[model samples]
Structures are given as structure tokens and as C-alpha cells.
Target: MRIYLYILAGLSSALIGWNIGQFFLTDIGLFKEFPEVTLFPCIAISLACGMVMNEIFISNPTRPKLSWRIAKTPLLIAVGLGTLAGLISGGISQILFLPQIRFPTPIVRIIGWLLIGASVGLAEGLTWRWHSMEAGDPKRFWQRFKVSVLGASTASLFAAAIFELIRTTLGAMPAEFKGVEDPLGFSILGLLLGLTFSITNSPSYLGALRAGTGFEYTGENYEDIDPNLQPVNKSSPCIDKSILKFVNNGDAYEIEEGLSIQLPGTGTVRIGSAVKKANIYIPGLPLHVADLELKNRDAILKPNRVAFNCIEVNGERLTSGDDIRRLKHNYVLTFYSEKKDGIKEPKIYRFVYYNRFLDPQA
Candidate 1:
């Protein structure tokens, strides 16, 4: 299952990278003469990045010789993965898009595939390994994912802005399009587009940012989120392997920092800590309890409207009608009570989880 997920992620990343590359290439006029080279690299990079995304984000011990061997395996696999992704993406683009778009010949296509895979592998591997996404909790999975995407997309947008600026200086970009080609304009536009791709694809660049920087998104869709908002760190869902076994609470309940929860007809819950957040996840629910309420200090709890849908952190709330604003490293959560008929006192349950750095780094 894990291996398959990695492959799927790699394929999607390749497609997104190719599409983003094509968008830029078209603006730069590379679409006309060297269309082949323009997109191949993007596909290759995305796949390569995807191939190693798991190792990149999850905690693992560093052994030089072992690391080398693992690294080699992904690189070797990337060749094939890149080729497959490129061909599929290119074919889909040609079939569905404008007639003016050109598809590389069979031989050229294969060569392009190889190059793209190699380049994407190198770029993604280096970046993801160096900077990985951290998963504070399941509630934070998507939030961190978006943050990672934003980081990579920001990088991509910056690159495009620089390119446009250079072109303007060289008078390569026409004066008529000058307004359209303004660095700020290009950057804004590229940022939106890159964000769209990142969200849809969940590439390692975005994932890496989430892990390394502790960034995340609380918004529904990344493109709709404010650029001025603070950046989110991409987080991985999997706990570090070395620590995973020890921290095993047998899946009772879990929560992380900077999260808030609201329970229907009850109250609110918020949880966060100083220095670092806790890793929170819930296993089985007690049979007696029907639902629960979680809210922050200031939130007004409504009745029968909100059901405990697990956990919420910072600005990302889980249940419907739950609202989140900003993500803070520090947070608090209040778990509400559900009582049955004839029961006077609300039955409370205990939540268990692992705290900061219980196990040594792998």
C-alpha cells in the first residue's frame, strides 16, 4: 500500500511539474523551438521527487552507506517512473489542449523523459531530504501539505518573476505585453497557478516545506488563501519510525499544538504548547460516548450543530461550522461531554498521547 501510494504521488507530481513548466515555457517563447526540452525536465523532477517523498518526510536514522544504497534505488527507479509520467502527461496535454501545442516525436520524447526524470529526481531528492514535512497530527495533515506547496510555489513564482524581469530588461518581452509581464504581475499570477498545481498534486517540494519549516494552511483551498498570511510548514502523517513504536499509545486519542476543537451543544477545545507541539491521534471511541465538544477560550459553543470530528488545531477546525483563523505554535483544546438520559453527571474520558521528543532522532 505504501509503495503504491508513493508511485501515485510521483506520477501526479510529474504531471503537475510538466504543466507548470509548459506554462512558463509558453510565456518565454521556448514553446516554439524547444518544446521538447521545456517540459521533459519538469516531469522528470516531479517523479524523482515523489519517489523519495516518504523517506524525505518520515524520520530515519542516518547511515552513510545505507543512505547511499537507498538513494541509489530511488534514482534508478526514477528513470522508468519519469518516462512513464512524461509520456502520459504529454499525451494528455496534446489530446486535450490547443492544437498549436506540439508533441515531441517518439525518440525525442523518450530522451526528454530520461532528462526530466533525472533532473526532477536530483532536485526533489536534495530538497526533500534536506527539508522534510512534519506531521504534528492527522488534523494538521492537509494544513501542512498546503504550506509545503506554498513554499515550493513561492520559489517557482520567484523564478518566473526573475525571468520576466530579465526579459523586460533585454526587451525580449514585447512592450505591448509590458504591463502583463511586470514582475509583480507575473509573480502574483504565477503564485496563483503554482499554488493550484501544488494543491492538486501535493508534490514533495510542498510536502518538504511542511516538514522542515513547520508551516501549514488552514484555508479550504490554497489558491483562495491570502498570500500575505503566514507560511505553513508541510507535515507528514507518519510519525518518525524510531519513535513510532515507542510512542504507541494503542491509538486512544491525540492532539497537537496550535489546534482548537468545537463540540456541538457543548463547548470548545484548544491545545498547543511551548517549544514544540504534541503528536495527537485518537484510536477507538468508548461505546458510552455519542459525541463531544471542543472549543477555544473565546468561542461560544452551539448545541446539536457541531459533532466532534476528531481534532482541530490553530485555524483548521474539523467539524462543520468550526472556524479557524491563524496557526500558532501554541494552542489549547477543551473536550466537551455527552450524557445519556437519567445520567446526572457527564462522563469524561481520558485522552493519551506522546509528548516532545520521547525517542532519540533516527
Candidate 2:
């Protein structure tokens, strides 16, 4: 399912990119005027698709959302550099085909515009997708450069078709810039852009597990179930069954991140900063919830095998989205209810791992 989603995302990005490029050229009066293809409509559709895909694939629930304020500088630098490279590449191709002769009325202009579109597409790929980073090998700087170069080359190959289709000529000598776009000039473009993207978005590249789960609250109150009034029933059946099972089995569980649905609840199940597989959810907790796969020897599950890690305590993040995090052995997760909204913290629910699989009350 993960692989399929990634594949779907890749195809979606490509389709979005292709349309964005076509619209860019179309806006400035290129692309042989195909009927029913207006620049504005294409731009709108392409932008919409790009945004949808971006949210689906690039947006991380655990991490703070990247605002336009944060992204603006990166976007500006990327677009500017991309446009410049496109122009340079276009000029080179023109020199090769139109060597010693000048074109009439902006055939060069057409190529320049088309290259800018190609450049933008490459920037999108480099900025968001490149993540493989090996630390401290002849140092981090050179390693990052290598990875960016590889990723950029791959991205540019896919993006080159955008420039190739522009169909420009000088005095009827067809510009054979197709060869130059993919393997050579675009590689250089990718190299530069990749370096820029890596340096600018370094936070994402480090790829460490985020610490401190987000917490929040609800306006509604369940007074009879008041955590302050009543003691937390650790053995409550409503406590997330799937997650508690890990604790029961005596395996260490780390909440690497992301899940929803507090499963099998008669009233409300308190799942603190953990995602449960419940068919129903009545939110009033102060913790982020998520279901995810975390592999580590420190965990109690079959060393390195996928296992469930849910905490049955109510929690809600005040900022960002839900974010459940790494766990410690025999720890109590405290969170607040809707009634406790004004209070900064939630009630506590503790889990004790019983080696049911290993012992029978000896």
C-alpha cells in the first residue's frame, strides 16, 4: 500500500508538472494554439492538482506545516535560478543550431520561455523529493552534493521533455536541443538546484524522529467520566486494545508517528498521543493520534518486525497536528479532558507490560 501510494504520487507529480509546463508556454503564446486549451484554465487546473498532490504526498502530519512565509524564499530562489539556467541552456541550443545566423521575431524568446517552465518543474522535484543523506564521509557537504547531483540528474531527465517540445527554429534550421536538455545541460541545472534545495530545506533532510507529541482539548464535557473526579481505570476495556496489547505482550513500543480511530469504544476511549484501530471516535483528549510502523531493537516486538504501539490516554496537540512520539518503559501518559481544557495538562493513564506470552502468574 505504501509503495503503491508512492507510485501514484510520482505519476501524479509528473502529470501535474507536464500540465504546468504546457500552461506556462501556452500563457505567453506558444504551443501552436490548440482549440479549447486556454492558458488560464490550464494554470488553474494544474495549480489545483499540484496543491492536492502536495498535501497528499509532501505534507507531514507530525511536522509543523510549511507556511508560504517559510517557503517563499526557497521558491523565489529556485524559480530565479531555474529561469536563468533555462535561458542559458536555450542560448546554447540556439548557438548550436543557428550558429552565425540570427532569428526573426523572438524564436529565441519562445525557447527561453519554454526552458523556464522546464526549470520550475525540476525545482519542484529537487526541493521536495531528495532525501537520501549519508553523514560525515569526507564530511557532510560533499556527500550532500553527490546525492543532489544524482537526484537532480534523474529529475531533469524526466523534465527535459518539456523543453524538447517547444519546437523553435532559426531560418528553418530545426533546433536539435533535445539531446542537450536531458543528459548534459539539465544535469548541470539539476546539480545547482539540488544543492540549493538541500541547503535551504536542510531540516527535512536530517530526518530524525520528532520529539514531544502535540496536545489539545475539546469544549464538551463528560462529567461522570471526569478523570479528576474518578480514578483512571488502567484496565478499562475502552483503552486502545491494539496498542495496549503491545504493553501486555511485554515488548517495548515507540510511537514513530501518525494514526487515527480510537477503536471499540462504548463511551470514549482515552488514547493519548497514539492512533488506535477503532471504528468509532469521540474526540475530547489533549494528544495527537497516529498509527505508524517503527522498527528498532529497543522495541519489545519481534526485534525489527512491524508491531502496534498505541497509548490509551487522551491527548491533543495545541499546535500543528497530532504527533505521538517515542515511548519509555512503564511510563504514565497524562492528558486532559474537555472539562480540563483551561488546564494545561490532561489526566494520566499508565500501562504495565505483562509477559503473558512468557509467564502464567508464577
Candidate 3:
């Protein structure tokens, strides 16, 4: 469902942008004075494409709703990069297709559209954050750049080639719809660029975290169920049985159910009670209970000082000072909290980790 929304957003934004550009170029007489004036429409299309792509990237179900204030910085960066790309590609295309240059008309159109698609892809790639990379990871930028640019460009080239074939083989349309080709072509390019990027960046499921037998209540007894937690198969076999719930207690939101968090193949994810800070937020736990690091398909659980005496993995208490334990399939992490009566209850919350990639059942 979400993927379909993304594709729709991409296609619509591109079509609208292209129409806006066309209006300015033909209707407003901007292109009649100078051929180089085509850059304006390119800029419009690129800016719209950039904004939509960035919005899709930053969206998260567990996070707060996005507002203009929260999304401005990244959106601005995307716009700037996208505009620059548009300028370079548009300028180059114009120069290459000049009458004096004698370039083949079909070849020129194909190259121009390909460049436009690549520029949008490049901007999106540059703004993307690689979740698997930690600070100072040297390969991060290069990896993102390579994947985004190549994927987008290839998709765009394919779209342009198809559009060219349709235009040449089908001949011109009716006089009333004579100028519809550019907008239609741009829309196709946008759809393909977005589709290719999303397919390439789809998450590879390492496994999931399920509520263990010892797990307690997820929310207050009187609280209504969260709509986002509605039981539905997310299509991933590992997380088919898992459900997520968000509990708001005025100050912050908490994860009531053991949600399946995508553990990056490499990098550390903090597990704690801090809203918006912890990768996996468990209510009533310390702000920083532990760090779960993935290395070579192994999950390393390191308990922090505040949670040393409270955390137990597979029924063994975690001690203070850098004690790290490896997690296995069906291993339960039990968290304890003292009740108002001063009794320390065991198994306040239990998270069972399962790695389907290596499991025989998978």
C-alpha cells in the first residue's frame, strides 16, 4: 500500500511539474525569445520531484507526524541539489542538440530525458542516509551515490527509449493534443525513477522480535487500541505474528508490543524508553537500557549501567561494565521493574528475537 502511494506521488508530482513548465514555456512565451529558456521548466520539475522524494524517505510510522518545520532542512537540500542537476543536464542537452551540432533528433531527445531522470535520482541519493553506516564510515557516501545514480539513470534511459519509440512509430497525435508528448514522457520518467529507487532500497529482513511468554500488558487497562497496531500480515514471514502498539503517557510514547525493528546488517541500535531517541522504545525501561549491535549476522546485546541489574537475557542477569552477550533464536530478554509495593517483578517485558534468514524453517 505504501509503495503504491509512493509511485502515485512520484507520477503526479512529475506530471504537474511538467505541465507547469510547459505553461510557462509555451503559454507565457518564455521559450519564443530564447531556446535556453527551457531551463525554467526543468527547474520546476526537478524541485517538485526532489520535495516528494525527500518526504517519502523521512516518513516513519513510529515517528511523529511530519510538518513543514520538521521537514524543511532536508527538503531544501534536495531542492538545491535537484535544481543544480536540472540546470547542468538541461544546459548540456540544449548545447548538444543545437542545429549547428547536427546531432540526431531522436538521440538528442533520449539523452536529454535520460539526463533529467539521472539528476532527480542523484539528488535523492545524495540526501539519503544509509542506516547500516555509523559515523565515520568511509564507504557510506560512495555507496549511496553509486546505487542511486546508476539505478535512476538506467530506469530513466529505459523510459526515454520507450517514449521515443512510441512517438516515432505511432506518428503525431491530433492537433489538439500535439504538444502532450513532453508532459507524458516526463511523467513516465518520474514513475520509473521512483519505482526503481524504492525496489532497490527495500529492506532485507534479518528477522523479528516477538513478545515472549513472560511478556506483560502492552498498555493501560482502559486505553483504546492504536489504529496502527491493527493485526495484518506485513508479508514478511518472520514478522507475520508480530504486532506494534504505541502508548502515549503525556510526556512520551512507548512501544507496548514487541515490534519488529529492522536491524541493520552492521551498526548499533539503542534499546530504551526514550521517545524518538531509542531504536526500540520499551515503556518503563531506563533511558538507555542496552545496545544491540549486528555483526556478521550475530546480535550482540550490551547492557548499559542504568539497566545492568534490570536486564536478563535467557534468564541470566546482565552485569555492569561492558558485558556483551550474543542473542540466539527464541532467546528472551526480560526486563524487571519494582512495583509500588517495593516488590521487584520479574519479566515485566520479554522480547524474543528470531532470525529467519538462518532458521531452517525459513
Which segments of candidate 2 are over 4 A away from where they belong?
1-57, 61-66, 99-145, 158-362
**Stronger candidate by lDDT (1 vs 3):** 3
Reference-based TM-score of each model = 0.29, 0.31, 0.56
**Per-residue CA lDDT of candidate 3, range 1-362, in tens?**
65575567667767766666667677887765444346533543554454344444434433434334344554666666566656666676677677899878777667666666666666665544422221022464566568777887798788888888777755756655646777677777777766776665453335445554433443342225662343232111121112221111221223335333334566777766665466665556676788887786688888887678878888888777477888887788877653445556643767777653221111
> Which stretches of model 1 miss by more than 4 angstroms?
1-34, 37-39, 46-61, 68-137, 172-246, 249-361
Report the C-alpha displacement of residue 325, candidate 3, in angstroms. 20
Q: Which candidate number has the best TM-score?
A: 3
Residue-level lDDT tens digits of model 2 in 1-362 = 43334334434533444455555665665543331123222322332233223322333423334333234444554545544554465444455345366664244433443344344444444433222112212344454445544444444443444334432332245456543332333233233333333343233221112112331222232333553442132212122334332211212122211211111111222333233443112234334333222233121211101111233322422232243343333323333333454767544332332111111111
lDDT of 2 at 85: 59
Selected candidate, larger TM-score, 1 vs 2: 2
List RMSD in Å for every model shown.
Answer: 17.6, 17.0, 13.6
Instruction: Rate residue 189 of model 1 by lDDT.
Output: 31
lDDT value for candidate 2? 0.34
- Shift of residue 220 alpha carbon in model 2, Å: 39
333: Cα error in model 3, Å: 5.2
**Whole-model lDDT per candidate:** 0.37, 0.34, 0.58
Residue range 24-136, candidate 1, lDDT tens digits: 68776665544544465455545455545444433344554454544554555555555555555455544534446554333333333333333443344333323332233
| TM-score, cand. 1 vs. native | 0.29
